[model samples]
Target: MDGVDLGIEPGCIFGLLGPNGAGKTTTLEMIEGLRRPDSGSITYGDHDLVRSPAVARERFGVQLQTSAFFELLRVDETIDLFASFYRHTLSTETLIERFELGEKRKAYVQNLSGGQRQRLAVAVALVNDPEVVFLDEPTAGLDPQARRNVWDSVRQLRAEGRTVVLTTHYMDEAEALCDQLAVMDHGRVLDEGQPQELIERRQPGAFIEVAAEVPITGDLRLPGLERVTHEGPKTVLMTQRLDETLGALAEWAKQEGVPLTGLATRTATLEDVFLQLTGRSLRD
Candidate 1:
């Protein structure tokens, strides 16, 4: 990543958001001292990462995208193994209970569910009792309920006064968790701010959504219309003047004999901000 500069605040959940191949993982790895950047400085307060990566390693806990543990090791044993590497560590029992892994404490690593494994990974990361935690796609693949469970854990981390640097492509995750956000695309930082601030600054207008079957074959001729695009089975019309756009849309629908099925209007979100900056959807 080039021209990337970010300052993560203490005791807040900071998110590095982008799609796959957008360099989110690379950025997180660099900060975690897993990969060194060719040039640029990484510092936590007075500690310089380039000159002293050990300091970062000692102070920051890491949960990689894929955490591999011995398949035969029990959950408690796995936590004990990771805790052995740190000078200062939390109690394994507390860690297991915090992550909601007490029921699977005796289960082998290979037998746990995907959500359980992910929780165990985060628990292992916290074994060091580090001040800052780096989580790379902490909730990548899981059911909705599992994803929400991880979210709760992350919030608890912030509540405990630990700085969390998380990378995720899920817009809802960013919106729900991040106190500060750095939107990245390709290999550069696009924008940085709080979730709502970035959305209002980057995509300040409202969006009008209609069904794709309405057959909009050409550019829409609505006042204050910024752009029109297709998202799955919906046609989205972004506009600065919501009243004028809605009036024009109603007239146009009546004139064209098109049914405005599933019509809705709402404020722009972080997903809209990402698309506005990169010209690509967050899921793409």
Candidate 2:
């Protein structure tokens, strides 16, 4: 990671938003004391984390992207095992109930479903009852319902007054769950702010999308239109004034005998902000 600096507020869900290989995990590891940086300082309140790694180990809980537990260990046993490592910890029974794993408490790790495993991972992370939590791509592989379940758990952590820091590649997930965010790429922070603030600051306009068959071109004259680009099978028009742009687009399509199939309009999103900053899509 290069020159990445961030300030996480207490009791909020702070996110590191980036694509794969953007150094999100590396940054998390360094702060968590799993990997030491070659330079720079890390601190928690007045404590220098670099000089006092034990402070971080004792005060923070982590849920790694991939967690590996003994396949034969039961759900409750896994939580107990982790709790044994901490000087102060929450009870296994409490964690099991809070994470909604009561039914699976007796089930072996290998028998749990994807969502169950994710819940178990989170449950174990809280065994220490730390003041801060670190979740790395917590919802990366879960289905929609399961993803929402994890989202609820993250919010619950914040409600309990613990600082939650996470990393994610999903634009919607970051926008929905994060109170503050740092947009990172190539090991550097591009911007940092609330989701809507970043969107309004970096991408203040709205977008008009129509079927590619609409025959709209960059040279087309439309009031309030700023730029035009093609994405997949849709033609996107960026406009500062949504009402005037839509009116002009309809009139132009009518005059040119073009059908406006799949017409849609929406405000700028985190995906748009990322593209504008990096000159590429998140998947790129």
Give per-model TM-scores.
0.93, 0.96
Least accurate 10 contiguous residues by lDDT in model 1: 211-220
Error of 2 at 109 (Å): 1.3
Clashing pairs in 1: none
Candidate 2 per-residue lDDT over residues 118-229, each given as its tens digit: 9999988899998999999999999999999999999999999999999999999999999999999999999999999999999989999889464566478999999988
In candidate 1, how many Å is residue 260 off? 3.3
Best by lDDT: 2
| lDDT of model 1 at position 258 | 80
Tell me the lDDT of model 2 at 255: 85
- RMSD, every candidate, angstroms: 1.9, 1.3
**Candidate 1 residue 185 C-alpha distance from true site, Å:** 2.0
Error of 2 at 224 (Å): 1.4
Shift in Å, residue 151, candidate 1: 0.4
